[model samples]
Target: MDHLACFTPGDLQSARAPDLSSYHWRLLAQGDSWFSNATAKLNAHANLLQELVLKEKACVVNCAGTGEALAHMVDLESAPDFVRLLSSPEAPVWDGVLLSVGGNDLIAAAQTPAHTADGKEVPLHLRLLRRQTEWGPPSAGVARYFSEPGWATYADYLRSNVRHLLTLRDQGPSAAKPVFMHCYAVPMPRPAGSEDGGLGSSGPWLYPALKAYALPGADWAAISRLMVFHLAQLLKAMAADKAQFPGLHVFDSTAVPLALATPGSSGNSGDWHNEIHLNHSGSFKIARAWSEHIQNVLAPPAPVGKQR
Candidate 1:
């Protein structure tokens, strides 16, 4: 809501792409709650960076939907222009594209209790842990979210979507564009109810599933960390393959420093507003980090004629 003037209604409805002819630099962002963030106003972190930090005319199209629906909303074939600026004869080359996805995908799958090979229900975090018996060598973690038929299937889905985005960047009307993706911030799983209009109004987000697996409330902190860390590991692994994804980068929002955890501090926490979403202060911390990262990306290349 912060920059209602920045995006037209069509952009919000995903009906028509925004016109980018007037701006010197443009960015197309596609993803979920992290970027849209209805919970917090001033959802346009891009605008904040452009105004206070970069001091440039940066046009942003926020096509972030819910986690369950985001991938499809920005499908390469469906929304080809969702992650690229509108092409005009006089338009400057796009500065970059930002993708804030994958967290919701993982979150949805994680909340489901997957059945193990032995017909036992297991939480996602425990399934990923290496286990061994006294009589045999250690076995690897459940191939992936145990419910999934095969881990390769999910990996393929992620690979295909991301590959398509990178391909889009390469084929832009302008020169090759940088593609940046962000990892979700670490969220703690506390049992605070929605009494104060916290995210708990949505039912503790991932708590029911954790409870289904009989995980103790005391262990929620460690489990929460494990789940988030696992997702980060997967993303970092993909980003490390620079050969396969040139100019692709990840903004590690998970690394943002935070104050100590306080009891009964649901919305008061300096880092999180609830289990899943960040409060205003928390959002700014991340937006600032993103601003710095983007500034580096948008830096102009040294001039060839100035070599002397």
Candidate 2:
């Protein structure tokens, strides 16, 4: 991966080392833990950006950080560095932008406790999942655990923020250049917290949220899968609607066949470093598939007269 050079916002802005023109592709990356977690120094625990091996030499100026939500990422006040590097006069002409957001936002929303108009508290109706007592019979599948109105509100919020992000990109030097995003793979509900060699630990997000709603342990995986599926559909819809999100490309990372983590694990299991983040093997698989997809998209169209 020597062909790939990654820099923090400060390093890229101040030094601008490794002349930008040297790379075949110059990209800007912004997102959450997937893009910027430094819990472990080993390559095995490197974030998505560090694991990427593109078809051509590429340099990425990363403005992402751990625990950043989509709303914060899109906010000018919260993301001044990202804003400046993207749209300012001194901004670079990036070949593309890579984004890894919405995951944290979803988690936060799921964990939100329901509140009454009178400011009273309610435990049965969480922001995303309804309590088991409110669920339909087991035959209802994953649909039984979900709150329709809650999901609708969340969907609207996600779409609106994504549109805001697109607007920001259009205002930048990289206007109309491809902006690539991914639908995250489904993770099993577990007690796995990302103990990244003790740098800092966080998560088991969905696990606790579901527990608070008294969801059955056996149904955790199915519930999580359905949630991820819906998210993927939303992203696909945005990509298809060129009128709204032109040049937006979404990689259906969920389609990648990676091993699943065992339920109830407190540490690394299968390909997962924890509950939400992927370990080296899993990340590599996803990165390779995504890289190939991007390469195909960037390839020039065949000449009209040429046919096999």
lDDT of each model, Cα atoms only? 0.55, 0.77
Clash number for each model: 1, 0
Score every model by TM-score.
0.69, 0.89
Predicted candidate 2 versus true structure: per-residue lDDT over 137-211, tens digit per residue: 778887888877777877788788878877887888888889899889899889987564443436668898888
Which pairs, if any, clash in model 2? none
lDDT of 1 by residue, 74-132 (tens): 44454434543433333336567677767666655555545666888554343332122
